[model samples]
Target: MSQQENPSSLRLQILTCHLAASSRNMASEKEAALAAVPSDSRTIFDKIINKEIPAKVVFEDDKVLALRDIAPQAPTHILLIPKVRDGLTGISKAEKKHCEILGRLLYTAKLVAKQEGLDDGFRLVINDGPNGCQSVYHLHIHLIGGRQMNWPPG
Candidate 1:
């Protein structure tokens, strides 16, 4: 969510505030994605990561950042993104070198879902490209929860 709406994001706000308040080592997520379509520089995610823009950060570390999605598609929609791109635009662009970080991202998502009090279940999604209806070009793992999700999602 936007920084303006962070206070209202409830769980996310609480988590981030608690983390930030607990540790000064916690680096603020930037504003927007670092990369955009046409392979240009800077996307909305970079702003969010930098805190240049605002987002309800749920979890963060030196390598990754998890935050609430501004345009949530589910009751619990959190986007997990790499703190640094390192040339990973999406799954399609994933190279052999990307395997380690990719695995870390998925594992982290699992860790985050559990940490979010989702003992029942959760869904992980990655919108690939235009065909995937992805408006944002940067790669992000969408962790959706709080309901039953179906196969062949529309």
Candidate 2:
């Protein structure tokens, strides 16, 4: 018998369709929430930089701040961010004027990694957008180390 002619099969198909639609709606809602705020608006990183929010700062210079990650993926996960965002919400938003600061962020990451005694090795990551799993809007670099790293990171 055709699936439509079988009540059980028809019910299963309907349920599957319902679940798919629900999943799509949930994804849409999540995307909407992520986009609710303007990209250039202040993010949690801004609060941390401003000292409005407390963070375990490991290193700080005139232009950059390196702090321990709240939810560390590795034993030595630190976030390096520029004090003045200057419209750099992500690396993709970088312009010519942002070059200096960008270089500074990377160099500071290196310094922090060395300070953390990741003498063996470390990884630097800059997640750009929603697909990159970037929860924060402000541009920053992640210095992860203290364990063996695997290839093809998600």
Candidate 3:
């Protein structure tokens, strides 16, 4: 039968197509656009690394750099990042080769927490995408402390 004559079948087909597309879009919603881009592409982190923009640098090495976040969520808030992007746009884009840098970033967060006298405790956050509220594409660990952290962080 012709589609127009079969109104119910037409409605079903439209609903099915819409549902399929909706599912696919939802599946990809968690994906970051940066994942498709070259990881070496410069981000604002490069400016912080290059010292073109002044940041309260707290720690630095040949591999990693830690600086106090300008918009501090806690009394002691620092951002630990790799000196080299190395195709690490975010943790979601991390590959096996990124293990070393990822480890360094986390370890640096711990060491800096001690230095900041957050012996009580601290929070390390790696925001991945829009849902994580990751404004910058570069991979960095946020170390926040000097106060009690609430559970179920929004």
Cα lDDT for residue 42, candidate 3: 82
Candidates' C-alpha lDDT:
0.70, 0.77, 0.75
lDDT of 2 by residue, 1-154 (tens): 9755664654454344334443343454344334433367788889998999999999999999999987677899899999999999888899999999999988888788888999999999997654454557788898999999977564
lDDT per residue, candidate 3, 17-122, as tens digits?
3344333433332233323232357877899899888888999999999998876778988999999987788899999999998888888888888889999999
Ranking by lDDT: 2, 3, 1
Residue 1 miss distance in model 2 (angstroms): 44
Error of 1 at 57 (Å): 0.2
Worst 10 residues of 2 by lDDT: 29-38
Residue 81 local lDDT, model 1: 93
Clashes found in each candidate (C-alpha, N, C closer than 3 A):
21, 0, 0
The residue pairs in collision within model 2 are none
lDDT of 1 by residue, 1-154 (tens): 7653443343343344434333342223211211123253676777788889888999998878999987665688899998777677778878898888898899999999988888899999896643343446667899999888877565
In model 2, the Cα lDDT at residue 88 comes to: 92
Q: Against the true structure, what is each candidate's TM-score?
A: 0.73, 0.76, 0.74
Q: Best candidate, TM-score-wise? A: 2
Cα miss at 82, model 1 (Å)? 0.5
Q: How large is the C-alpha RMSD of every model relative to the true structure?
A: 13.3, 11.1, 11.5
After best superposition, candidate 1 residue 53: deviation in angstroms? 0.7
